[model samples]
Target: MSPLLLVVAAAGGVGAGLRYLVDRLVTPAAGARFPVGILIVNVSGSFALGVLTGLGAAVAPELSLALGAGLLGGYTTFSTVSVETVLLAERRRWRDAALNLFGTLALTAVAAGLGLLLGSAAA
Candidate 1:
């Protein structure tokens, strides 16, 4: 395997570990009423990706791939969001479910846009 691929894989493992730690830390404070942990993870990941994208030619392609596709890919998770939404719906918490689904989408998009703008300016 390529050395770059190995770096990305290692970075992904680190990212996943970070995700787990963040969730564990935030979940308790946010409580079981909502999955605030995952929400934070996705939004932050999206923003970081936007920054990398905005950096454009300033960042090397290999570094970008390792951080974007590897680290952030593992850091952010739509699957958890989907499962949580379904679980909320199953419990008949329609409002929370809708909020989780739509809210996350909207928030992450905005975060990414903002990150892009900032990243571009910095670049």
Candidate 2:
């Protein structure tokens, strides 16, 4: 195994751990009505990815791969979003379900765009 692979794996583990902690911290405050935790994670992860992408050649390829495919990859949770949206729908909370689904998509895109702009300017 390559050293870069090992680094990415370790980063992924750390990202997953951070995701868990963020969920634990946010869920209670946001309440059971919506899956705010996962939404936040996905959005933030997207933004981070955008920044990494925008940085482009400014950052080393290895570092970019490690942060994007490793850390943010582990941090985001599209699967969880799907499950939660389905659960909300099954529970007959159509508004929350739709919001969770569409809201996440919209928010993440915008966040990523903003991050890209910021990162590109810095670069």
Provide the overall lDDT of each model, using Cα atoms, as 2-decimal numbers.
0.95, 0.93
Q: How close is every model to the real structure, measured as TM-score?
A: 0.98, 0.96
Taking the tens digit of each residue's C-alpha lDDT, what string does model 2 give over 1-45? 999999999989999999999998999998878899999999999
Off by over 4 Å in 1: none
Give the Å shift of residue 87 in candidate 2.
0.6
Top candidate when judged by TM-score against the true structure: 1
**Tens digits of per-residue lDDT for model 1 on 1-43?**
9999999999899899999999999999989999999999999
RMSD of each: 0.6, 0.8
* Backbone clashes, candidate 2: 0
Report residue 69 deviation for candidate 2 (angstroms). 0.4
lDDT of 1: 0.95
- Poorest lDDT segment (10 consecutive residues) of candidate 1: 114-123
